[model samples]
Target: MAQKNYSGVNISVDEEGYMTDSSQWTKEIAKEMAKEEGLNLTEEHIKLLEFIREKVLSGSALTIRAIGKSGFTDIKGFYQLFPGAPLKKATKYAGVSKPSTCV
Candidate 1:
């Protein structure tokens, strides 16, 4: 386990930087995470994050293809929203574990 300081709160994370406890997640933490990734959370980004979190909580698996088909955005749009490993980065900031499909 590792720790990341987000807005003065020390949150626990795994080796790959995914939050260990979803309860520790906050919008502030999410914002901080996005800042670390050189992004500013837009309304669309928040929508996608909420969508991903809801899907995960409902016991659905996530994939780029699935996300693309969900209508939130296409693959290119997703990559634009979250450059470089869109699924990995989006899920990380969403306070969820790295998707199984990610390396």
Candidate 2:
């Protein structure tokens, strides 16, 4: 595990930078992560992040197909918004642990 300080909160993450504790996540942390990915987060992006976080908290699997039906966007739009590996990157930005489905 690796530790990183974001907005005065220290959190532990995996080698891929995925947060280990979802409780430590904040919107600020998500924004910071997205920014680091060169993404300029908009309201839509925030909504999608919240959607994914909610699903994860509810013990649902995070998948590209599931995210597409989130009402935020379709699969193509998801890729447009999140670029490569939408599930992986979005989960990382949402401060959720890496999904088991991801390699």
Candidate 3:
């Protein structure tokens, strides 16, 4: 695990930089993480992150297809939002564990 300071709060993250404790997450932290990932969090991004966090905390498996069906955006739009590895990046910004579906 490693410590990353975001908005003056120290967060514990894994080697891959996924937050170790979701309870430590905040919108400010999410924005900082998004910025580090080269993304600027828009209202849409925050909504998606909130959805992702809620799903994971509720013990639902998160998938690209699930996100596509989420009504926030389609799969292509999801890709466009996070780019590269959408699920991975989204989970990170959501301050949750990396979904098992990823890699």
The model with the greatest TM-score is: 3
Tens digits of per-residue lDDT for model 3, 17-98: 9999999999999999989877899999999999999999999999999999999999999999999999999999999999
Model 3: how far is 2 from its true place, Å?
1.1
Model 1: which residue pairs collide? Answer: none
- Count clashes in each candidate, considering only residues at least 3 apart in sequence or on different chains: 0, 0, 0
- Span of 10 residues, lowest total lDDT, candidate 1: 94-103
Reference-based TM-score, model 2 = 0.91
Candidate 1 residue lDDT tens string, 1-103: 7888999999999988899898787788998999987899988998898889988877788888888987889989999999888999999999998888554
Q: Pairing residues by index, what is the TM-score of model 3?
A: 0.95
Candidate 1 vs candidate 2: the TM-score winner is 2
Which order, best to worst by TM-score?
3, 2, 1
Q: How do the residues 2-101 of candidate 2 rate in per-residue lDDT, one tens digit apiece? A: 9998878899999999999998988888888888879888889889999999999899878889988888899999999988888889899898987896
Candidate 3 lDDT trough over 10 residues, lowest sum: 94-103
